[model samples]
Target: MRFDFEGKTALVTGAASGIGRAIALELGASGALVVISDLDAEACRSVVEEIAANGGNACVFAADVSDEDAMREAVEFAQRKGGDLHMAVNNAGIGGPSVPTGEYPAADWRRVIDINLNGVFYGMRWQIPALLRAGGGSIVNMSSILGSVGFAKAAPYVAAKHGLLGLTRTAAMEYAQQGVRVNAVGPAFINTPLLSANLSPETLEALAVMHPMGRIGTPEEVSGLTCFLLSNRASFITGSYHLVDGGYTAP
Candidate 1:
């Protein structure tokens, strides 16, 4: 599971928890100095501490991904700390209201699209230049099973995720010859706080049954693929969506 990122640097949004945290830790362990980013400074620092305790280099930069200026600053901040930006994982996002499409709040929809879709764009807008400055790099945009399939009561999230594929593909095509690689990672229901806190046991069980694997995936599992995509091991891979979805979309 280890890849050589020695002397390289990476910026990971939503690194304070869940799949993002796992990717940050793995990237650090693989020898890359990590920039841990999230909305909460304290939580970001906690992840930094964990990386440091494990003999990995990391720093915290708190920023709301929905803000374009903040995201740009975050990329700049990481470059200042690490001397270059070789990788970026745009993993920050939010789950909008659980109500059905008819009842879904307009404000909530905008908030979700802003964070999940616009946030990725903002992250890449700055990250691409940073990578170019470093001569080349990689990016992994976090998508979801909902990106490829319909999910009840999750109109905004679904739309935003689907949008990511288009963005990822176009960015890949535009930057492929320029040495930057762009791709998306779609995970099924993960055993993260986001899902556990929002769903009842009955609902969770129902979701598990929807997957061919009959179980939810762990954050580490998704992180493994993410790190691989960021590594030179996947140098020929870009503009594609890799599913860590327990075969949820196979049907």
Candidate 2:
């Protein structure tokens, strides 16, 4: 699907790899000037180069999503480079240690919540104003199927994701009247470098079968929905959570 994002500027966090990378590339290809924000400078630059090679315009802004100052700087960078900020995708997240909540380490839980939940808040804390300043815009917060349901031995991740939905909804309601739409995209078991690095092939195959589609989704699949929510095509959408999970949460 193609979107006409001409004259629009977008800021995408954690855009150097995985699902974030896919969204950034798609936005750029669709004619938006993209700001690739990620902690890895090298990886962010690579994404920028890839977008440029594909006849798209993009720039890299390396920053830790958990840092409010850095996230603010990222938004400023996007506005300075691409003009008004019309779009944003808060996709930076991390899967915490697989341990029962009772035994989950305080440090690990804090880290997970900080990155997966608080980071998104920071992004929007700065992003919403920019969009409002631009007159109108959209924001897609990357959630997970876990946002709707619980998973054993994954309390921190699940909690953070669940919290994200509340944040998305509140932001949507507050800004919808102002022409800034806010929504969440929940993807399940996407095939990304992070997933592959953490799970063995045998485990991955097990997870694939858990989904009704009998396969884990691809980052591009998640990106398709994400880009749509960011586009004018979803102009009527806001304060809702869309699942691209192959029916993982359907049952």
Candidate 3:
């Protein structure tokens, strides 16, 4: 299971905090030249500085993943900094307001769908050609356990995640023979700020108990799985979905 990404360049979106931040740090630590993109410009810069201080090559770019123009600019920034972009983690997304699907606010639904679905689409549509020119690469879409199943109060979020999985599968099939591997990571409950703020403590405990492991997972745990999927070590694992969900879906 030893995999190295030395000499490779990786672009990670939504990297200012939470899962995206964890992924970026892990990728940088694993020897990939990293370009961190986030809507929060300051946060992005901080991540780059931290990586640099830690002896990793990194640069930061700010962009709203939902904006096509922003996504393009972010890619260019990565290319300029890393020289060759070889991997992408389309992790930009949001959790829509919690409510019954029927009562979900239209604006919130649109916002979530835009960032979670359209954002990834934009990232891939633009990155694919560059990745091809760079001689192929791996892509990891950050879906959720909701991608595989429905959650009662999370209509828009569930829809977006499910869409992400479909997009990953379709893109992987389309590019497999061409040497690109596309995959999705569906984590159930990880200790990201998203969960801490958006989800209540009781809900978190309930989610933990739902897992056979009797606890939620961690960001580093998910990072281990993501790093594998984004490396040559997973050459034959395209069009796949991984569950790093503390056994939540196993039962």
Candidate 4:
């Protein structure tokens, strides 16, 4: 799908891989000056090079999303490279250890919350003002299907995702009159490098069965909806959670 992002600037966290990378590349292809951000500097550069090769404009910004200062610097870097920030995808996150709530370690819980939930908060802390300064823009927080429903043995991740929806809605309502829109995208199991590396073939197949479509989603599938929300086409859509879950949450 073609989106008109000419003269706009977009920042995508976790752009080194997975859905974030797909979104960054899509934004670049749509004519937005993309700021590819992730912890891996070299991987970020690689994504930028790919964008350039495709005749799109992009730059790299390496930062750990869990760090408030680093997130601030990321927004600043985006402004420095492409003027005011017009769009942002707070997509950086990590899946903490899988354990029952009773067995979940305090440190692991904090770490998960820090990266998955606090990270988005930190990104928006800086991004919201930047978007306002740009005369209004869009922000998409990458939530997961777990945001809408509970999954056993993933308490921290589920709790963080659920919290993100509230954050997204609050920000959306707060900025609605100001023309800055905030929304969240919830995706189900997606076939990405991280999933491929972590899950066995049998495990993946089992996951696919959970979706009504009988298969895991792709990063590009999630990116398409993300880019749509960021585009002007979704001007009236805000404070909403859009799911790209292949009917995973339908039943």
Candidate 5:
């Protein structure tokens, strides 16, 4: 669907690459003054340049989503740079060590939960208020197919993604009447840098077959759903989960 975000401002976390980067670019191209955020300053700047090159407005905000204070500062940075915070995409996450739940490394589990689950809460903590101040806005929290189903050797990631659904729903209910809309997006394994870094080609191919579509998805595919949710076109959509999983969960 076509969307115009003129005069709007959006903050996207984990926007250095992958799905987050796609979302940032989509919003920017649609006319929103976008704030690109991630852990790496250089990577975030690169996204900013890409947005600018497309004749779209964007800026970089480097911050660790796992850090509560840093998350708040990131939101504030968007407000200062873009004049308002009308939309937010909390997409920062990590896949922990691949080990069975019983043998999962405690540290890795904590770290995954910190970034995937807690980071989203931190983003909402700051983002919700800013959205309210902007006279209401929208939020899209990135979940996964794992949010609904279990995955072997990914206990932490599964658990964290599941937790995001509850958070998204609660926040949506609380603010549904107040103006802000909150929702979660669940994607099956997409061909992102993180997936490439962690999985071998053979493993990825095997995983691709797990989806009925016989292939993996892409960042732009997920971004299409995300930007739709962020726009007025989805005014009635909130406090729910939408899947772009290539029928991965059809079973």
Candidate 6:
């Protein structure tokens, strides 16, 4: 069955580009009033403009997910734009400190925890109460295959993503009876611009070979599963982590 979010309101973080931007646009196109946010003010507005140009409902807010005040304001801005809050995608994050834990710089470690882990937490901390007031909603936290398993040189990121699962599960349990659902989407080697910061041709080939499907993934691929989890189609699917990886975890 097709999932439709007609008349719903959604707020997506890190929506300036990549997976976050795609998710925001897709949700808007699906009949939801969308509020797109990013750390970059201009980029966030640009994405919102693009969404509007495509005949979707959207507005933009600039905020750093790591900043408690900024995230709070973003949600407030979304509510003012949409007139209500029904859903949110806590997708703002960064892969920080790719070295061994012992050697990982303290500054880098803090940055990863601040954005990757703490930022998600902040988003949820503020969003949950808002969702409750709006009669409950769904929240999708962006995770990665790294959330389930591990890889070399990504200790901080792996640790943070793992912690996110624990948070998602706990929140889902706590809110299951409250008309709210919390879930996660864990993708593997999705070809988003984020990859440009790390993966090169050689590494891309290695990643493609690593997945049992013999291919990487796309942001839209992840968004498809995410939208499902956000809609009523996944009403009974809270507290679960859905992997959108190309069978990378399978033996």
Clashing pairs in 1: none
The positional error of residue 41 in candidate 3, measured at the CA in angstroms, is 1.4
lDDT of 5 by residue, 176-241 (tens): 998999999999989999899888999999999999999999999999999999999999999989
- lDDT for each residue of candidate 3 in 36-95, tens digit (9 for 90 to 100): 998898999888887877787788888899999988888887788777679999988887
The global C-alpha lDDT for each of the candidates, from Candidate 1 onward, is: 0.95, 0.95, 0.88, 0.96, 0.95, 0.88
Cα-based RMSD of the predictions, in order?
Answer: 0.9, 0.6, 1.3, 0.6, 0.8, 1.2
In candidate 2, how many Å is residue 99 off? 0.6
TM-score of 2: 0.99
TM-score-wise, the better of 2 and 6 is 2
Residue ranges of candidate 1 with Cα displaced over 4 Å? none
Residues 1-251 of candidate 1: C-alpha lDDT, one tens digit per residue: 57999999999999999999999999999999999999988988989899999999999899999999999999999999999999999999998778899999999999999999999999999999999999999999999988899989999999999999999999999999999999999999899988898899999999899899999999999999999999999999999999999989998
lDDT of 2 by residue, 1-251 (tens): 89999899999998999999999999999999999988999999999999999999999899998999999999999989977999999999999889998999999999999999999999999999999999999999999999999999999899999999999999999988999999999999999999999899999999999999999999999999999999989999999999999999988
lDDT of 6 by residue, 1-251 (tens): 35688888898998888899889878977889888888887988888888888888888788889899988887788788777789999998887756887798989988988998999999998889889988989999999899999889988899899999999999999999999999999999888888866778888888899999998898889888889999998889999999988889987
Q: What TM-score does candidate 1 reach? A: 0.98
Worst 10-residue stretch by lDDT in candidate 4? Answer: 74-83
Better of 1 and 3 by lDDT: 1
Cα-based TM-score, every candidate: 0.98, 0.99, 0.96, 0.99, 0.98, 0.96
Clashes per candidate (backbone, < 3 Å): 0, 0, 0, 0, 0, 0
